[model samples]
Target chain A: MNDHELDIILKKSLQPDVSVDDTLFNEKEELKNMKPMWIIKPAIALVACAAIVFSVFTFNNNANVTTNNSSQSTDTTNAFALKVKAVGKQVIELKKDVSIASRYGEVGAWGGGENDDNNYETDYYETFPIACEGNNIDKITYSINNGSFQIINVKGDGFVVDGEKVAPLDKGGILPKSCSDRGITNMEDMLAENYEEGYYSSFTVDPDFQESEDVIVNICDNLTVDEETYRKIWCFSVGPYKDKDISKLSKEENIKMLELVKEGMNDVLSNVVINCTVTYRDGTTESKEIGVTKIVVTPEEAKTLEGFKNKKVKVPSLYTAYKAL
Target chain B: MNKVEFEDMIKQYGVDLLRFCRMYLYSKEDGDDLYQDMLLTLWKKRDKIDYDANVKSYALSVAIRIAKNRRRTWSIRSRIAPESSYEQMLDSGTQIKLQDSKAKQSSDPEDIYVNQEQIIMVRNAANELPNKYRAVIYLYYSADLSIKEIASCLKLPENTVKTRLSRGRALLKERLEAMYYE
Candidate 1:
């Protein structure tokens, strides 16, 4: 349909019939009868204070235990402790060995245990480390393989890990049947639960390759880091895709295709340039270009990487995936 | 603004504001609640608002801000609790009410059926849009707001509003066509 027809339909569909007069009258009456805020404020404040104190105590205890346990693990240290140095007043240099892994892996059968041989498909993703310090990141603009930087808009109140803001990226995944049965359909809830269950170790954001610019991904916008701890932003999947006629390809050909896809993704990751606009505590803003080291790895090699073993790292963008094709 | 002036303003723009809330929230009950909240907020801040300015635009901006804040709170709450019986009830009830209202719009049974189906399809398409586009589209169409008014309310560039409006229309049309063919 044309724009005018669509506009008419939109107007009809959106403008629902309702008794506005009654609604306004009722609302006005409610407003007139509403209790003064002073009476409720103190009660709410007391309850809020109690809740905050209890939560903080419990959280600190849990955090202490977590810190102790994590400190003992080399893998955790390597994965969580991103290395960076101040290049100048505004720039921070990422170490050359800091790299991202792009992997192509099999998710499962298409229809969940239907077990048809033709249904097996592979997915691709790239996992990288991002760090911010001394300021809140408003947004990150990243260029893949020297392409134009695409802006990822971040939002949310992220958790602090070791004085650094650790925000989860939107690594899109299907809600498990068990969770769905429990009426847990929110992706954030699922991600939080998964993180708690040790299924996810770092923050993830879903990669959008459809648009050339302005790919918005929600994370913690208010995350600020101190001098010491640099938060490691985790893996984001490009989103899942079913292979086209995987049944027709020979086993060797399938393996080759996966390798090719992996290579294409790594190529994008290798030549990445990320710039972040940060809002400092003093209200000053600066856009700093982050330097990254590119270490390309195969799926097998990725498995041997510290803190990455036995974990399912989802792949990133259709752009690289289709490029490989 | 005085009480009489406020009431007059509400009478003039109340339906559109309520419609905007419902479209934004995609729930009749929540929309009503939001509308009430907006009214109460507007009433409380009446002394601070300038009477001669674009009062409608100011009122809408308040509604948008409140709606956004409410949506954010809902997201956080949903993450914590995962589900709420009240929300489910509201959603299902709203769907039924929408269908019933559409059916009552025409006397002819066949026409009513077709109209209801078309309305449902369009609503679904609109609902599926991302918040940015949906807000722009709803403000432009449902609230009868001009592009300049929408930009002011949304705090977006006029060109950005135009782009989102165009994109929202394109997406809506695509979805409607797909539903029709299906």
Candidate 2:
């Protein structure tokens, strides 16, 4: 085809009446539009933030293939600016009775349930099935092993006797921690940055307004408001989702994914209802000014949280659940 | 520099942009829809725009980018639309063949002999060309852009732009000669 011929033909193909100005840019709306922020822990202390619209985290053992429930990581990296870490107390009880080959009726050194290697590093702990009998309470003495030692009473009722009650564990529960628990030993040394390391007794994002770079986790305490229940609350922000990206969700997608995650978290939170609000640029607000609603967390997640499973803890009150947006 | 400049910019480039729009997107409705959207985006981004930069270039760039994106969307929609009606036979049907016989029917009575048949044959031949060549030819004639300008607007290298134009021209020449020159 000659250039001129092609030009004339192409030109005519474009009907003169056709208007060309109506292009829409929906690039801002991506598939992972409404999801919570999550991280894939690579190692201890090297905690890094990864952002993905949709991602899967899985592990397998032998022929048992399991597809993990997928989740979206939507947290703003800048929101977790405060780098802090916390060391929570966890009492790992090996449910099965462990023992040695029964050498000489002497119950030779080989039989025990506890891993002694871990004993040297506990923030606070005690040995059991030992030589001491009757008292259940053995003579308490301590060593800091790698770090310093501070005695803490693990009440038989399961509360950490640290001047006040924290989230209590059952007969055997790993000590709970959050981004707020890194203040026990030395707030100065522990709080070197956001996501610090150590135990903290409480949380209330100090200087909260300064766009927190800190994410503190405590191994020995519970952030769940009421100390009576002994249940821990883990709170993290997916995003400041107040702007256009989330608002763009066509009332349907936002709601669908929100229901999914809320369902997933239900097992852990037990009837935890998420209250949500959206603030638009027009000075208009979509708030619980919308209304309060219940979200049934998933059954699998409910199993992970002892509190969620218990007949006791009050139903969770969270306004941050994804809306039908 | 505010609404007036934006409105003025639209008025000046609006017709040319409309011509550019018609080349790829078939429907008049779709083209105008895109044109409005482009104007709004220009107005929205007005403050960030380099006031000294060529508004025509910027608007054309935005239009092309938007057009490509819209084409992707339309392709998806087209695939999903009813298999028959959405394929745009209005442009491809025998009307264009009939149009092939009628020359530019200008009322000037100047007897310039602008055979509408020649124009229709030319249009069909161009439309039948590969999308790349069709686009280059569209930009060259309909958009009145230089090779370098087309390259910058489409984010292609100048050589590629020239190549597309030359190749597109060659194809059109071959097709038109085969169909009409005979």
Candidate 3:
């Protein structure tokens, strides 16, 4: 048949019949039958059990609880002090070892130079890279405190802290400034080159943070992707630690710790402000669901917030971030 | 209208929709899935869609957009499917090994055998055409749009569509004649 005649017949043969109703449209009303709170009960119970065990083994045994009389709050607040003490802090090994000193407490401190305040001043670095992917840092962090950070050195593959041109870390993995002179080489250089005007973004988790244990949160001076004012990004993460049973976390709480870790890391590594979203794995999505959107704050802005400055507000560590998970 | 009315519209044009879907997709499941997704899009944007003249064409337009997306999605996996070649698939890729005695007993040449042989022939002929011309032909013949319609759909001048159509027809004619001749 010629095309038109054939098309007519095809149309006639294929016309849809409307008499039938959908059989596969079965709604799972059984879900409606359940009490709305039923889903959260098991989660609450599991959290209660874990709280008891954790407090006993990780806390009660090591209790040297102190009632600090800070005007911030009147409640007995040293609940995690013993656990923090038991966690056992480690010192970083650098030429002049530096310790992180943020005015805020409970900011998880993962990696940094020792005696950073004496050697480093209050200038935030811009577009720095921790190379946490190759470094295999699962959530490196820093504490937030009162006043502006006088950042001298960044924890990149190398340091340009205070313009002294410090040497870089990895023998092979990280690209140095010399390589930056060579046509734009890595993710860090690309971010630095593209940082733009004074922009603030809600801290967002790097979309690809799932496959590797590294989370890099770039704190931008501008909210949009402007390279000119864009200063620093923090890098931290918990996984591809693949073994930390993430199934226990509420998707929202899980993303929060990642945000803090990322935010804290960026704060120490660079000098600029960044807003990020805690990006995490969605059960079925190839894309991550951003959890507790992390907002990067300048020390000045953070200090202005009530109940925030100087006091160690664990500000939700992995425990509080995923405590209910 | 509402979802029920929208569904009714889909049901009204359903047959031509299935035919168009089937012509593009080999699997019935994929065709049905595309249909449902198209229906959903139509339902969601029911007020905005101009379904005046030909609901079938309007729905087909929606189907085409969704089908292309599905094709892009599936190509990631189906790129390596064994059906890539008519030669391999037509031959069954699974030839029964004949015993020595059976090989000697077979009188007919293996090349003479056929089942739905025209499908292999048509596919091979189509595969032989260049992509640009093949696109016009596939849209006109399988998608069942008219030449003028195909030109508008492709955003090409009608003359260019006619030229490509002629070029495609010549290629298929040449291949078919040569194949049937010897």
Candidate 4:
């Protein structure tokens, strides 16, 4: 087609039906729904804090009773507090010397027209570090929304020893084959995997991979855990894993696994609770339950969250952002 | 601007703004959502708007900003959780129906078919362009905005807008020709 012919075609195709009435745009409804963000933020923060405090107190009380019944020698001290810095940008920090942060890297893209450079858009999937104060930690188990607790174990090679402190293999650690095999580098692949499996592999590390008792308790007495150094050592994997092997499961069992995967993926960071079991050199064991309440985010991430809350940014699915992360 | 003036502005330029949104987003549903959001935002910021200035230009600029922000968010979202095949088929069906309705002026079946094919080709070609080029092309042709107006809305120089339009047209021509041959 000539330039003039192309212009005519372009105009015709690009111009939408302007005569159609907008039934969706109701000013009165929109105005009525628009509450000031300043009012909503404080109310939400207060409610969240109250809920966290109540839940933590109840959990700690139950743990104390259990410890008292089981063994009179056990220490039931609340030593840890799990605070979520941000939801979309998942950052879990311990008061002592451990921090776990999930980051989505734009590895690559696929599927674009020959002439379309803009079509190459990055697909995001989460890779996070698994670090903890290994000296006192006997075992750590995490649960989502008061669900059954699942053990958090080291994956890929083994723990990294920094003088007396030990942390799980950081960012360079190998991820589960299931995650790597799917090649989740683009939108098309991600969607295909989501449809077929009903959910992406929620955890970066193999949850079923159990570490030996020796590895779990390998720590030195003189070494102090550096929270800053551990925080910087980002890992490729960390999250709750399924109890059973997927390959060995029956069809019904497979379905249940899918359900669990979907549930874990959907659960927000706010709902996550971590239970840390500490072991002292004197052979005394202590149980501590950490509850997440306050969300501390950087200024940039805060802006994005605010924009999302204000409805300025449209997220297609409720937990799709989690999938991207 | 008061509510009356806001209502008037919507009455005058709402359709164009909605059309701009649809073109930018490439989805009727999302376009409608953006349009409502734009209207709400405009109403919220009505007092701050210069009453004597080009209200349509201001409205279009707001829509553009919203579209850009939403797309940045949606880009990640769409990649992870794209619409299902059934939903996509439904969207395609809607597009065909829209094309058919628009082509009602043509009596001949062959002419309607040709028109529909041509329209889909042109749209697909345009959609493939980068946002910078597509925005300029859509504003110039779809929204009927001048280069000066587009420059003002985008906060880019008039020369930059002109360059984008020219490059956008060239890319569209190349893609359309390839599609025609295929």
Candidate 5:
């Protein structure tokens, strides 16, 4: 059918079934009881950092020692110094953990969503303590811009970054398939293009580059496809457009253009990968250069596109955008 | 927030939250657990939430984060019993109920049959979508949230949300045509 009919069917099918029982909120009884105490907990975690650290470490280690037991002594005079040392060590460890967590959190959780994979930060920290076990930490510092992290784990080379032993950047095999697939272009080829002119930029792991090893992924600059090419396909597929310069268009005009693009592109945009090269660790690469004419649109989408073209929408062919690009 | 206010807030947003959980998580059982956990989180942070802030949006944001974290932990569970398709995720009883609901709305026998089948087909297709696309579609269509509201809730650009909705609808349209024509 037409767009209107399609919209009707979708809206009708997706309507919420509001038959939920009122008693659903009754289960909130237990939650309500814990409210005030739970509300104050993050503040507590921030203030009583040492205690929280102690409890967390103790719980994870399954250690039987309490804060009292760790410092209790028959010599009252020495107990004060021993307690001070223990607190100092605990503070050091807490700083190290938090530093590691924050550094990796920025890397791993940066621009990530619920559907996105591999919290690099959480994964790094999960195995951090165990990996660096039996080492005494004197300092833990990291650079924000560069992923270079330094953790003083005395056993030596607990993990290595750039051939030096460090904690944060040493965890291995955290690459996503999108970044790891072979037959793509070489790292340099991916980085050769000026991306500011393009619609989007992507970051992926480049194992072949020996600069950073184990946990880090490299950004490929040349691998980016210009947004105009995709936007053209998207715009044409949504409806029709003139060869008007995108730069000359007003903000409202651009929005209208995007709205049409949305209508035409439908959901097939994710699958619309152009021929690109992927570099392997061995320095060899392959190209998956499927043309835009071969863009994977379903029969229904194709039919709908044709219908729009036949009508006043005057949608252009998907290949027209590809050919122009 | 007072107990009465909390209850009122829940009453207002519970259906939307439950529906979101169901759509996001393939299993009803997992959805139920996530729904409870989300409410617990909102309750804990109730005092911190401003009175003028949009509670529904805030609750949705919390629910999404909780679900994402839980999914990460339960990744193995998903792998072990992969509900790859919505048809597989839906129980026979639920399917029957959906069919009956459609049937009650239509007097013509053929229309009833077609409508039921179409519903099942659409639901399965919707389930197959990538999480991002499915989420946008559910919020827009089922929850009746605007594109702006959805973008705000998911912390995405409005254009991104619009693109996803377009892509999601394309998939749904593809499936509907396949079932109807072929």
Candidate 6:
């Protein structure tokens, strides 16, 4: 078709029919009558800010009360930070070094009680075996190749010779030494510029905030109430979720509540009133709120303790089993 | 803008916006729905828009943006359910009309009949154009937007818009000729 003919036809086809019904008129009218964003935007932001502040205040206030109650009680020893590593004493019985033949002597198969006409009895040993080892006292001792001696009192019942009750295996004595182990041996190795390494914890920003960067993870260790113990917590700093973005969520309030829950758990883990302070690469420090629940040390946590008594001791291969001295 | 002013703006530019959308999109229903959505968007963003600026151009730009976004969403949806997208576009019997009219033709037909068929073919051909070319064509011809204005609206280089327009015209001509001869 020529340009003139095409143009005329296009105009004719493109134009809406004058008689066409406006089915969408009501919808359009509703939209037109809708409040302008200038008013709604700030209103929504204010509501969101009020919501966040209210939530943070209420949540932190409740958390502070819980912390104070837990701390004031004279039983701080039982009060583990939510899920701190709990290591307890386990007493494993030492197995006796006795052989089957020594215990049973000679077994006679199909032997009669007193006498049998055609006896199927067979004697394995010419004489009955006596007790193999001497009836010694309840003291167990081991000398490496008959050199230096190591003694463990069998009847001591997990008590040291001084009569002090000691845990069979104590984790408190085993301090953390590696970053992953919750100990920062070297600050240089533990601090990461990007999300690649430093502990990546998660924290929600102000409901009205927008994040330019991703959430950064940092590993933080604070000395616990027990001077010897360092409470290890992961600090996560996430970019803000803007009000508009939050509004896009199906349940913005629910998400905000979830963020509050995260904050609550982080508060319990870090034991901080607000955000925990984190040191950056350039020695500049910033406070980043904790985002995730603290890591709990299970009873099955690998034993990190090295020596028993100035001597390198090999722990038993099995978790609950004990290695005899 | 007050409610009356907003309603008036919609009545004035709504038809032109719908035309741009219809020529730009494959489905008239999709275009119609998109037109309503564009009006809603304009109403919401009315505060940000400068009253001194050209309202028609702004509406055209908004229409184009909405069309682009809808196409993007459709493309993603089509990948997930290709048959559903095809059914949606062709469910209105436009494809059937195009197919039926393809073989039956006359060396010469009545003026009204020829005009009617040409209009259908033109709409179909414009719809069949690639999204980039279709967008440029609609803005240039239907919206009467300058090449520079189209580039600004689509956030593309002026030279890119010009190239697309030339390619789009050539393609549209080919589609029309194919309908006529074949």
For candidate 5, write residues A1-325 as lDDT tens digits.
4455567666655543434672175454654432111000010110112111111110021211123221222333211100000111121112211111111111111010123521111111111111111112211111112132222211222222222222332211122122223221222212222111111122221122212112222111111223443333223221144335544555456555545443333222233333223333234443232111112222244344321222222121111112111
Off by over 4 Å in 2: A1-325, B79-128
Better candidate number, 2 or 4, judged by DockQ: 4
i-RMSD values for every candidate model: 12.2, 20.2, 19.6, 8.8, 9.1, 29.6
lDDT: which candidate is best? Answer: 4
- The better-scoring model by DockQ among 1 and 4 is 4
- Residue B17 lDDT in candidate 6: 67
Give the Cα lDDT of each candidate. Answer: 0.43, 0.35, 0.34, 0.43, 0.39, 0.36
Each candidate's clash count: 13, 64, 56, 5, 16, 3
DockQ of 2: 0.07
Candidate 2 per-residue C-alpha lDDT over B1-182 given as tens digits, one digit per residue, 9 for 90 to 100: 46667666666766667666655454344555555556656766878776566677677788766665334234323322322422332433321223222343533333223234555456566655777777677677666778877887777999998898888777777776687547
Residue by residue across A206-287, what tens digits does model 2's lDDT show?
1111112132111221112222111111111121221225335444444443443333223332322222222222333332
* A45-64 per-residue lDDT for model 4 (tens digits): 11112111111000000101
Candidate 3: C-alpha lDDT: 0.34
- Candidate 4 achieves a global lDDT of 0.43
| Model 3: per-residue Cα lDDT at residue A109 | 16
Which model scores highest in DockQ?
4
The digit string of per-residue lDDT tens for model 1 on A41-81 reads 01001011111111100000010101112223334211221
Those runs of model 1 whose alpha carbons end farther than 4 Å from true positions after fitting are A25-325, B76-114
TM-score for each predicted model, relative to the true structure: 0.40, 0.35, 0.34, 0.45, 0.42, 0.36
Q: Which runs in model 5 stand beyond 4 Å of their true positions?
A: A15-19, A26-114, A117-325, B82-117, B179-182
Q: Candidate 2: fnat, from 0 to 1?
A: 0.10
Cα RMSD, model 2:
23.7
lDDT of 5 by residue, B19-125 (tens): 66665675555566667777777776778876467777777788778766545333324433444434443442232234555554665433432254666566667
List candidate 3 stretches off by more than 4 Å: A1-325, B1-5, B82-115, B127-131
lDDT of 3 by residue, B1-182 (tens): 65565666656656446545543443334455555666665665778765555555566667766655334223222322325432333333212222354442345443222224434555456644765675566666655678777766666899999999888777776775587576
Model 2 residue A226 CA deviation in Å: 59
